[model samples]
Target: DAAHTAMWERLDLDIEAHDALLAVLGKFYGDIYLAQEGRLKGAEYLDFVLSEVHGLRIKELQDAKAAGKKIVGTFCVFVPEELTLAAGAVQVGLCAGAKAGTELAETLVPRNTCDLIKSFIGFKLARICPYTESCDLIVGETTCDGKKKAYEAFGEHVPMHVMEVPQCKAPCDRTLFRAELVRYKEALEQLTGQTITAEALAEATKVVNAKRRALQRLAALRAAEPAPISGRDALLVNQISFYDDPVRFTAKINELCDEIEARITKGQGVAPAKTPRLLLAGCPMAVPNWKLPYLIESSGAVIVGEESCIGARNTRDCTDETPGNLDAMLDALCDRYMKIDCACFTPNTERLDNIAAMARDLKADGVIHYGLLFCQPYAHEAMKVGKAMDAAGIPYLSIETDYGMEDAGQLKTRVEAFVETL
Candidate 1:
């Protein structure tokens, strides 16, 4: 394991701490992920990815660096990996799930900020995140006010690029977004010292589209009665997708889908038959932030789908692969990214519509509209979402929480009550 040791050394990562963290994650994986009944095949690969998350990915980055390739770290889905790949650079998702660095992050930002934002800053400030350390550039996006100011503090410490994400989906917003993408592309060129050609962008689009299609297939299988996969496992897959090698990730997902399809054929499922099926909405659930889903599933209901960024919202759309030119490809990226119904958008009917559609199509018995504590956009929009769900006759439960386990007992009581009502 010299290579593994070297990879950590090169990144200045605390190997001992990383191993300890993995040990904790392993126990959780066993209890939460492996404890599920009749699990599908190809899930072992995802386990391996989590076990060696920083080790394997960092080794790949080290090899790429040896070949004169750059690595880009992204915090939001709005930052497209296609452009990074087209520019001959690798993009990895930065750490945002662990609760270890929150105290350090709190010193920099308000303590009441969302844990996801705090986690990222904490990881960087504490220097515990290997992916953040390896990045030649970290791409931040203006998805909300907190992150907008956060990236400012983040920029002072690291080499960063902030994408100006629009709050509305007007024609003018698309124009502005396209221009920002152009600037992003130019920035990538400057960083990589290589011009991204139409051919390169087109090929990268195919790679990313293939990955999205694989995830979409997996999501479709989860809609089956007695869901072929647990919501926790499915969430883990999506979380890993952000960091794993794209081609390998897509292949494994398709393999898992095949196994899941077989499970559905045999009427096998992780949850028992007639379990109350639930759909989770609002706020991205990053890796290691499994409290809500875990509580819900343990309360005798199965999560059929999620309306959050980390779930269907991130994988539901694909870039147009038919775009023959870079301009058209950027247009496609803009269109797809804009289609995401972030709560930050003014008059975000698309989110409510998608939530309703997911609930209906997935045969969900209720919708658990989850929001992280003090996350203004999702918290504010929860009221609107609840009203919409009421009008649509879909039962809704709005839960606002932080990353800590202090609210676990109260959340369990509320969630169990909600499932009983269903």
Candidate 2:
């Protein structure tokens, strides 16, 4: 209780605001997750992560602090978690995806900014997020223009480190990113007061790669006919993967995958047989931004996969564990991070190819390319994705919305019509 109290005080959290935020989460979970049928058994573990998102992770951080460790919070998937782990620190995801605190964020940033960025700004400004508060150093990435500038505002209240993410996969570009990675490694070492040795880097690589393998296993099960797990549940697992402890998260996911395997064997599913399968592409759906997936699933369709950072795009790949030294490990990280086909890239043909491959592999009936309002990179790619899908003879729908429920009914109608066409 003292540790908890200290964390609360350290974060300068507004008790009432924090409680109100949790109340919203409770209602959303009850309405969406509790209403699902025959949910996976291991889903409760992830639910626990949400229910105690800050508490449990903060407890881990406190223990790590007692053992002389530091915690790093990151927003983008580009931040090398392995580096943090190697330097004896924890890397927790701090992206705020909920609708809460938007009013507070708007006071700092313009109303027209993307909701994801605004939500995070709000969470920090409102002091309602323990994970954000628990961070010793907040690592931001230059994935897009908005976030690069927004981090300046965010850094006013919290210590910040911004990674210069390269938009193109040119050899020179990767070299730049590799240098950033090296800089990040040095920063982590200095923060944690721990020198990152070759063994430590190799071990961290193994740990992260194992986590990826577990997620990949779970993903493979989703491809089964009838979908052994709901897309909403699968998405929750992916979202939690960012916050949960790596080893524990991997074990729980593998356990869930085992249950899903049994479900596949028994021909059990959350959706009815022959439900229209969907491939959701574009835009990372952070925690509590479950509107589109919930609407799609409840409207007689099953999401088989996603092409976003929160989905297979982040988990499907693994870091090379063969790096025997620090420099080699950084090179591996650079290679792995560069492989991510973010929309920020100049010629992101890999993303389109990934979408088609996901659609074909998962037997998706249609592709719903969802983007958040004001997220220009993904929004701009919507037309290109539509044209590619059209040429490939795949049904596609592009929907852009903010983090508000006002568009729920309209989105449901559009998604339902898309499923019908499928």
Candidate 3:
């Protein structure tokens, strides 16, 4: 602990504030995660990772830096982990889930910026997130207007590289995104001083794709009748995937999925077979953003799948590793990332179809669409999603909230009412 304290101090973190953040996080995790019943034995891995989230993991990143590897931090899933690894960098998803240093964040960005953007700015200004502080380069994307502008302010604080993510899935858009991939590859190459070789990239693709397959396995298992795992636990797995070591995280999650398969075989689950199963869609739930998932599960519904970036949206696709040369590999990367159904895209009918498919495949009774307050894209898509769900003969509930717990009781009441209808 003293060593970590020293490390955090070296990272220039506000030691007092970071310690307080971890203390609160521990109690919150205990109440929400540790208190769950009938949890899979493999969840111990989750507990260990979360426990060491700010300590051992950060230490590892520092060690990698000492070993001459760059640590690349990213907020959105659009950043390619394969390229980061190929360039000999450690890629991590930064902290943006909690409401920290809001006053400071507002000073950096407008008050009306979505909680996700503000949280990252707040984390940086507050000097609380080691992941943000540890970044050698933070890769940002122009996924939404809020983030595009916020990164201008955020760049003043951290070493930033903004990638232009095309807003449409067209031929020209693909060309633009491919060029962006080349730009990012050059960024990583420059930062790490290592040219990304086709061989290295191909290997990295396997590692990243393996991780996706493991998550996909876990997601598929949730389709079982009794639901082999709680939605909160499943969501936790997804959140941890972003921060943990790719190979180690993938192995641990596969072990967890194996446990889930066994549980399903025995018809043993965290919830009753007939519990109202719901699918959560829209917006990513980053680290410690467990409030909504906790409320939904506690209100007597089992979350069968998450269609958000932190959940399915991030894990749903893997890059094509069939290319043998650098140029072709970059194209494969571009093609794979373009498949993401983020609301940032125009004519994102793929998202609507994906949500309906998840609901049907996961055998969900309803869909709970989560939109963070001031998140314009998803908030607008909420109406379209609701109509789509209605036409599909599925019940839906749209919630707009923030990281604060002030509305927990009201949200819980609403969730319970929705569950009753199913």
Candidate 4:
């Protein structure tokens, strides 16, 4: 804790300094803060933010490299970090800029494609993620058909390399998956000749999971009253978690938790909604591009609750045993994040009913069914939920989304009208 506090002091941050620091950091973009923070603790802290921040930082590294700098571009996920560092290239993540987000993904693939796609598709179509340009190379893993398809389609535009995932399910595939990770490591050696020592992997693990622990703690503070954070504040915390040093972030969260707890004790939280509070259920990413929470919060509504795989579940169960090793830690975190993976595959009314019950518990005024366009599973189930909510006398509204969809003026009018109805 002393180590973390020293770093925060240099940053001139207190626990509540998150609000102020974000006010400053939001003005610029990159991972320098995270790298510096990592050094405050160790490699493990650095590796944690790497999952999301590397892409944002690559621009700095790549720009320097392009101008006669010896920056090697190691494909983010698939390429081994050791190999990339060895190649004299930066270990840039494929989904980096694509992950922490780029722009408002309000269109392109109909909103029904699940939010993560909306993020990539929106960024690619809009051309915001510098990775779309900065990346000298890209790699793909045939993990989920959905992600594979999106990457395959987008890869054609870049120097994309594809790795075949031997299997999708676990047990048989996990070994293969680990092998694939090793194979990916070898491919990096062939392409860049960087040696990925077990030590490096272990180092990466520690840094990355520290970031995970920080993120989890940040999520936990939301459980505080008068919510220790706003949706916008939450975004700031996430930025620090992804880009700043993980150890620093953990310290910050420890401080933030105190500040938030104070606020809760004082009966302060996110501002009360003028509009009837609504609990959003189903896939809400709007493509990782759109800040749906911010949008909703700014719109005078509170996402007092959700059924997102990441929102409640992933952020809550963040107790990883492997404190440092990036690989094992990431696998564990990934599995944890993926567990609540919403089965919007087809809404089970049983689950739907449970969601309604959750909303009731949260004292939500209504339910907003924001399913993406063409999201057959959610679309059908949404219609059912809409009907059920009406019967239960819970005011509800269903909004369909697509990337590059029609008039925002019209959408805004509809949203305004919904608020009025509530």
Give each model's whole-structure lDDT.
Answer: 0.87, 0.87, 0.94, 0.49
Clashing pairs in 1: none
**lDDT by residue for model 3 over 255-280, one digit each (tens)?**
99888888888889899879999999
Please give each candidate's TM-score: 0.97, 0.97, 0.99, 0.57
In candidate 3, how many Å is residue 180 off? 0.3
Q: Which ranges of candidate 4 are over 4 A from the true structure?
A: 1-59, 63-128, 136-147, 161-170, 173-176, 188-192, 235-258, 273-288, 291-295, 305-369, 375-398, 403-422
Clash count of each predicted structure: 0, 0, 0, 35
Worst 10 residues of 1 by lDDT: 13-22
| Model 1 lDDT per residue over 1-422, tens place | 78777777777777777667668778877887777776666888977887777677777878898999999998888998899999999988777876766788888789878999999998888777788888899999998989999999989889999989999888999999999999999999999999999999998989999999998888888788877888888888889888888999999899889888888999988878899999999999988788899999999999988788788988889988887777788899899888888898998988888999999988999999999888999999999989999999999999999888888999999999999999
Model 3's number of clashes is 0
Model 2 vs. true fold: TM: 0.97
Find the candidate with the highest lDDT and give its number.
3
Q: Rank the candidates by TM-score, best first.
A: 3, 2, 1, 4
Residue ranges of candidate 3 with Cα displaced over 4 Å: none
Candidate 2: where are CA atoms >4 Å away?
Answer: 1-7
Poorest 10 consecutive residues by lDDT, candidate 3: 257-266
User: Can you tell me which runs of candidate 1 are displaced by over 4 Å?
Assistant: 1-3
Candidate 2, residues 317-410: lDDT per residue as tens digits? Answer: 8998876767887888999999999999999988888888889988888899999999999999999999999999999999999888998999
